[model samples]
Target: MAFSTITNLDAAAAQQHSHELLDRILSTASSTYVTGPVGQGNGERVLVLGGTGYIGRALVPELARRGYRPAVLSRSAEVKNEAEYADAEVIVGDATKAADVAAAVKAAPTAVVISLLSGRKPNDVEDCRQVDHEAVVHGIKAAVANDVQQFIHISDYGVYRPELIPQVYKIQVEGELIGQHHGYVPWTIIRPTAYFPYLSVAFGDVKNGLKYRIYDHGEWNVVNPIAREDLAEFIVNQVLNDDAIGRILPVGGPWNADNTVTLKQAGEFMFELNGKTPDWEVITMASWDKKIARLGRLSKLTKQLKPVVFYLEAAKY
Candidate 1:
């Protein structure tokens, strides 16, 4: 069964709630495909779009260890020499092009196709549409034409309540998949929370005695960022599984003090870990809004400031 965990309760209560919820889910969960561990791969091929990324490095090897034949569709042939991709066959291709995606699917008789594709720039609307929405649609169409058994999409938790340009495209892709916009295809959608790296972006700065920046109060939002390895396992678990078909799973890391924290708490932890007193530069939302407005005006004159606007809006979110 598919489910999402909410971490809106107090720290202690949230931890206990997560534990109880997980226990209940495990006790009741059932899968239609349970013939063998990792099911019988039988050398069945699985095509992965965006397989040169951070999560793909972990996911490709896991699929190999589990007996599935992983085929990575990458734009760079250099991935062929990477140790992580050694276990899988690398098909050089650009996912943004429909013909390239179709050729990758047709290269072998594939059973499953998974997409971990997203734009490099979140603020660029055109880039987001091309990579996040159109590219994924290309993969989906390819999978449909090839009669692929399953198509799994790695979406973001932000799409649950979309505000950003990237998230908007992600939501659109989800709608197309669920509504059979192209053709009938069994699909699974995963909405994972933030990754640990995103949360630790300022750790080095804090260690260097830079004042930690935060919005007013900094307790407006809380997140539990999952590790790449953990997220990879979660995604692989759904591959070729009948129960996972047409399901949307929202997952996160454990709800401990270190894993679950607000923006303010994240900053405090960094300072404490670096053996320094908390030095926070809190910006009032009103002041931040003014800056964002200025950036918005500047973005129209040049493309460089679009990312700045996105980052500001994302922080406020």
Candidate 2:
């Protein structure tokens, strides 16, 4: 009888130990479910504006993977690829339209609203203003009306110093977005440097046998380009973290503080990605200035290229 009692006690201890081990393994495997103060778990509804764009396409999937339900608002009824958002709810509507924005916001009482809208071109100042500034204002009003808890606005790092003519639109929009949030709801603004895809323009001339153009020998300015997927992950992870509320976060790629890429380095990286040699041409500031001046004052191409010239010229600083 004494032996049987001891054996039963030992089996009970062994079962408890095994259960604890399983618990630890499950906790480690389910890291994404670990919620912060703002996180309401996987059932939280998130509304994403401009969800059909480059960044949004990645962001929606990342949100879904993290167990948050995401609903995307697009101007078109038919998404280019339906399977991409199989888990997300797709609402067809134009953000610029007040009614459409309201309908999407009210579609579900969202815990967070993220805006990834951007202008298609640098020279289209009116379109830029409308989409980046006005549409955001409208979206904010809609979110506010629906009692959304948080708002995340994606802005460019170039807006920090608006010396370029095209940056004015971004500057204005950033001001409106921050001003409108005004303590009513928690707002987080993310300013990201140029994305890797944006700098891939160097590849455009590569196939034509044209040497990649480098300004000031591509050594003056440095940029830390972030991958779109990484940026999307950062944004979605911050959604429910109250610590990120009202913070202006500047993010970069996985490079050390002292490690940054210049235009030449970026071009070389792209060339190497395509398994080709880095052929380069250096364009001096003086040569670029002369070319711009020769384009004449009333030329549309010149107007469109002003932002490019401004960026290259500013890089020398």
lDDT of each: 0.82, 0.69
Ten-residue region with minimum lDDT total, candidate 2: 1-10
Error of 2 at 125 (Å): 0.8
lDDT of 1 at 231: 83
Q: After superposition, which runs of candidate 2 have C-alpha atoms over 4 Å from their true positions?
A: 1-40, 164-166, 181-183, 204-210, 257-259, 291-296, 299-317
Error of 1 at 87 (Å): 0.5
**How much RMSD separates candidate 1 from the native structure?**
6.6
Query: What TM-score should be assigned to candidate 2?
Result: 0.75
- Residue 276 in model 2: lDDT: 77
For model 1, give the 10-residue run with minimal summed lDDT.
1-10
lDDT digits (tens) for residues 116-171 of candidate 1: 99887776777888999999999999999999999999999988777777788888
| Model 1 segments more than 4 A misplaced | 1-40, 207-211, 272-277, 297-307
The clash count for each model shown is 0, 0
What is the per-residue lDDT of model 2 for residues 219-309, given as tens digits with 9 covering 90 to 100?
Answer: 5345657778878877886887888887888776644332246666667877876777888887665566565445434345556664454
